[model samples]
Target: MNGRITVRIMTVVILYHPTMLLNLSSRHIPCPAKTIFGRRGPLVIEIGHGNGSFLRHLAIRHPDWNLLGAESSLGSVSRTFRRLKHAGTTNVRLYHGSGLFILRNVVPVNSVHRVYINFPDPWPKKRHQDRRLLQSSFFKLAAGRLAPSGSIWLTTDHAEYFDFSVANGKAAPHFSVDTTADPPAAARKTKYARRWIDEGKIIYHARFCKESEPAHPIKPTITTQPGTMHHAILQGTIPDVDAFEKQVHAFDSGHVILLDAARPLGDDRLILFVRVDEPELTQELLVEVRPHEQGVFVGVMPFARPLSTPGTRAAIRITSRWLEGCGLRLQQQSF
Candidate 1:
């Protein structure tokens, strides 16, 4: 899509009123308010945190700074979640969603003190370059979200991605790029950093700082015209029965289920349902049986139509068994 088109689409789908908190439930845990510097400490966010090793270390070593990690992969999020739980670390929060989403919806304006992009996937192909995380657009977004004195620290072992990142940072008028001769002393002993250094691959580090206030305020604008149904949902209004049926039909044909439901466990939080044919294969299952008085169950069954067949019946049976194991009971009707 053209840049204008893409921006517009993102504006519509991604942007929301700053006053309204988007995705607040995902960030359930409170962040530590104090920083190591004794003042309200800076908020540091790490993007693409794979296993939370670096974040865990950082949180412990720098107890004063509040930390947040954003990982798009659920598996990675779950792994990090457990690791933090086991270690009893309370300074960090995990956002299991896109970095862009978090930046737009969750992070307050001029709220982030630092950002770390560590070894993000390099979509190497020429046509796929747009998929690379460090792009001109992202640079602008980062600049807007960063505090006036804040900076972004990026590290990569891939030569091409490093070069691309440097070039992108330099091209942005707001950023002043700095290339380091050696890894920061504080970074050297980490397992990932050590391994990269041992391989004789020179790690590239760059600090991108915004030089001035943006000429324009970054506001959410709807870009892609939301489908009729989604438009209704966004407006806090339910679509008609036909549109809802079409949505459900679409879900039934697909293998995934995306449900917006009230927390099954008597918590004030909300729950998202990801329906699977054989839940056991996924390893863990936690079903909430009760709902908070104010919450309602919202389920998005991806393939509801075709899955009603006898062959698919086994999958449903397996799913039910798994939910039962997790202490989730089937409700007699939508509560």
Candidate 2:
């Protein structure tokens, strides 16, 4: 094939490769290797696999291992997917979500044999420390998912965050911290590692080994079932757009905020822009309130595939009930 034809074919493969992308919007435990990759093998995870250098290296280094990459940025995921596809790496699967979400919801307990977190964002300011990923809560969550004796290897150029992670690992239950060990060679081959190294920055490494099961059982934070249509039926007048005020509802694990209401120029539907904040995922989705012959239908808009999570369900339910207060009668709800 010509060079142009070869480039187009590769681009199509990278864009259309469906099997490697794990959909976090669906609530399926994606471990055991067989479920997603059609075979059983040792499982290894690389959090924040920026540009796919480390992820591709791990896949190439250990072809028998099932590799999972959790990345928060869609752009990075796409770039990494392109690199991985071009490398013909088949043992790896990537998710465009937080590592915590993958551990808590998608990965089964005692399934992971190793985890690599290379040069995570430090969130340096003291006020933003809570935003950092290597906290006590994460160690506890990791403990529940890691196999007995499974280890988490962390590599970072920020000394303060590295020390903070070591402290957090010590404070968390069921993990033994080792700060003197050498990081895996593939860890240093990441883009961030090379950049920091060339700039004369000192890198840090640590290993947190799971020594025992978690003292408290860790469960999936989002309990709502996926693939369900969340809506409500009302027998009274349709909600008035002018009276729509911002409403916030707090739940055990997350909160929902009803931002604003609008009506389409030529349609009888009211659009509600909602913000849902859960521990692992935050989604800004639209909910629609439509007037039907039987009743008023209030549900999540089907235009986008937002995860059917707790906060999402709450947004629909709260909007329905709030409309009741605004002169609409509640009839039924599916949440």
Candidate 3:
């Protein structure tokens, strides 16, 4: 809500470069091995590569395999980058957002050779069980993405979660559950796994092999386009800084929230921090309001690299209407 919020986000962008991170905003993932890694190899994904220890191991063990790591934590992504850089690992790429998004959107169907889920958060609380990743629905979803006879290897220290994954896999109708299997040697080499082993913890492991296609095959739903741009021009005066307030716009698919407004110290332009929340993805974008010859321009900046989705278009319209409420007349616009 404060101006300082923009400062924090800028600091993060300055620290991390774009080489290791995938641009989830892209519409289709045609061929990641050639596009991302600059070579062809089998695609392997690690659902939650904690600290990149196991991911680094995989890159070293199989240089011919293209490895992808999906993690939800920004700090973990940063730490993993440091480790990969130190080890000079090249076959690995990281996604610094939701693992589910990468699995659902970025990964091509029937292209993945293997998936490694090491020590996923158990979400032990009953109410939080729905948040766990290894659900029956996940097994169904993974089936549509994995290659024929491809497998998912899981290793966790929690007994209940291990059983939960096994039971869910059995119910999915796509995977053959194998509870009596030793995990890959790389699984126990993670930081948490090594510490748990030293403390004499019993770690559970399983391999869910993809047996067949889903009974009801699922397709990837992509509402965002890579090149499409949305914006609007209004004929009116600039909005009063004090009049800016948080506003929410809801659509059938998702909702967009205009969180706050900030004006640079010497610039006449205003920046609106927005949060766009959809079913599978959530993005933070900055909508810029700048003065034009006839009126004002309300649109997302090119630097934001925002994917043009329904929610995103609604965001620009919401901002334009808000400015109209502050005495701006709609002239010509695109949404």
Candidate 4:
């Protein structure tokens, strides 16, 4: 451990690049495999699928499988869609967000057949290594989604990272490092794979099998209650909306920071964009405060289509409490 460089995780997990999402990418997946594929099928997930050639091949090669690619860059998602569309591949679907988000919130437990993390961002610097996806924490989270027979296929051209992944995968109790080899034929054709190989760089490949289900997997219930959405109003005076600058409110489930607000002239609703960070998930969505007959209504914006979870309901409460703190009289409220 003397020469081993320490990798520190970056706290700010930015989900996506706004330019990359641009109406093309599907919204945050609340219900992972069910909503997109509509039926149960063999699920294959690829994280940070750059350029998507890796995903397109998997889709075309295996027509019976449901392929989901979670990429953070808009350009990556758009280009992948274009390529898959050109190939006329229908089983492939894309989501523009951190791979962690999809694995933690979207994909159902024990539903994935395999996970491909091919030539992921090395984040080579010691300080940025925490951002790399194959760490012990990530492996635990990813393992939670793998079926009894599922395995994680990881490949990288960075020698240090490859060693780190192997060591990290072993550190997690529920997984076993099954094998290591040169990049597989299917992955050897990737842009990075080829570039590194041509430069005489050695790629590290590992097949990590799930030995047992994680004892304490993150399984937060995602379903929203009856009063979670519409028709339920919070009866409170929403004091003047002037002091509504950026504010961070912490609740039991997680913390939500009101990023900013917008009032589309003449609209009945006041839109508040906020960042919600919970134990298993992180989402940036809108909480709308609309004028109600009794007082004012604060709820998750439907158009934004956020995951209706405990954290989101907590967001509704946070917004309501912020109003109460700002001198709003809360007689009765509905969650």
- Clash count for each candidate, listed in order shown: 22, 0, 0, 2
Tens digit of lDDT per residue, candidate 1, span 189-248?
445667887988777778888776677646532111111111001111111111111011
lDDT of 2 at 152: 96
Instruction: Please provide, for model 4 over 21-47, each residue's C-alpha lDDT reduced to its tens digit, 9 standing for 90 to 100.
Output: 222224343455655766567888888
TM-scores, all models, native as reference: 0.58, 0.81, 0.91, 0.77
Clashing pairs in 4: 20-74, 32-106
* Global lDDT scores for all candidate models: 0.54, 0.81, 0.81, 0.72
lDDT of prediction 3: 0.81
Judged by whole-model lDDT over C-alpha atoms, candidate 1 comes out at 0.54
**Candidate 2 lDDT tens digits, 1-335:** 12543453354345455678764455454435567677988889988888999899889989999999999876788899989989999899987778888888777888889999999999999999999999988888889889889999999999999999999999987989999988888778788999999999998999999999976658876644457857788887765566556778897778998877778799888888787889878776778889887799998875435777777778888888778887888888787
lDDT of 4: 0.72
Candidate 3 structure quality by residue, lDDT tens digits, 196-274: 8898999899899998876565666654556776889998777658756678889778999988987878998988988
Residue-level lDDT for 235 in candidate 1: 13
Off by over 4 Å in 3: 1-4, 26-33
The predictions' CA RMSDs to the true structure, in order, are 13.9, 6.6, 2.2, 8.0
lDDT of 1 at 244: 12
Give the C-alpha lDDT of model 2. 0.81
